[model samples]
Target: MTIVLIGYMASGKTSVGKILAQKLNYKFIDLDDFIEEKEHATVKDIFKNKGEIYFRKVETQYLNELLALSNDNIVLSLGGGAPCFGNNMNEVLDSSTATSVYLKGSVPFLSNKLIKKKIKRPLIAHIETVEQMTEFVGKHLFERIPFYSKAEKHVLIDNKSKPEIAEAIIAQLF
Candidate 1:
């Protein structure tokens, strides 16, 4: 079945999704990357030039396109905010033989992961202080948890390795 990973930013959805897909012998796709390729622009670029509203519209459109070709063995990593828009989450749940898995993490853990990775995450990169990072992650996670709770399964990823996290999610799916 399609394993749809959903969670807040820096929650390791993409990382775990890759490992799960490899272990399960399924195709792996990051919804945001798919949208970026289709639109010929990076997500940051889309949010920069056309604004967030326009970007979200295109995101919904792209999601619909992806879901149309449904199958049982695909793995998808959704955007952090994808579930908050319209009925996207419901549609994703209803469409394919999909399993929605929420990778739960503590606010402190998420803050540390994001800071340590030094990735170009447009959202939280602006926070230069520990207090700001904690507050930002805490508030964001709090706001997104309601949406994330809609998932079919919840896996806490406090300090797990990638393979362990992926295996945990896989075990829950079966």
Candidate 2:
């Protein structure tokens, strides 16, 4: 079975997913990294060069490719916006052996975490302050929750270590 982690930026999907996969003895795949390897460009460059529409199209294509693999026993960390576009959410939800988990984090938690890593993120790189980051997370999260909430499981990630969050997910999965 595949464990799919979905969430907004800074929600710890990639970090916790890595730990979760380790504990479960499963392979770990970060979708964005896979895309970068496949396309030979960073996601930011994909957005800049070909634009978001093209990126979203390729994102769905890659998502489908990953999901269709047989007996992979993988933990997949999706891009923050992956499920929010096109029919991607439905595709994930319909996958017979995939369990989709949303790493639910509050705006404050996300804002605080994102502030420290904004330079690595193209979307919020220009955010000037914590207040602005908070505002951006709040609004963007509101828009994405409909897609995120469709996940089979939801794990609250506030005030938790990565291992603790991984444990919570493991508990939920079993």
lDDT winner among the candidates?
2
Residue 42 lDDT in candidate 1: 91
The count of residue-pair clashes in candidate 2 stands at: 0
Give TM-scores for every candidate, taking all chains together and pairing residue i with residue i: 0.94, 0.97
Residue ranges of candidate 1 with Cα displaced over 4 Å: none
Span of ten consecutive residues with least summed lDDT in model 2: 63-72
Question: Which consecutive 10 residues in model 1 have the weakest lDDT in total?
Answer: 116-125
Question: lDDT per residue, candidate 1, 57-131, as tens digits?
Answer: 988887777777665478889999998888888988887577799999998888887776545886776778767
- Which runs in model 2 stand beyond 4 Å of their true positions? none
CA displacement after TM-score superposition, residue 78 of candidate 1 (Å): 0.7
| lDDT, candidate 1, at 5 | 91
Error of 1 at 145 (Å): 0.6
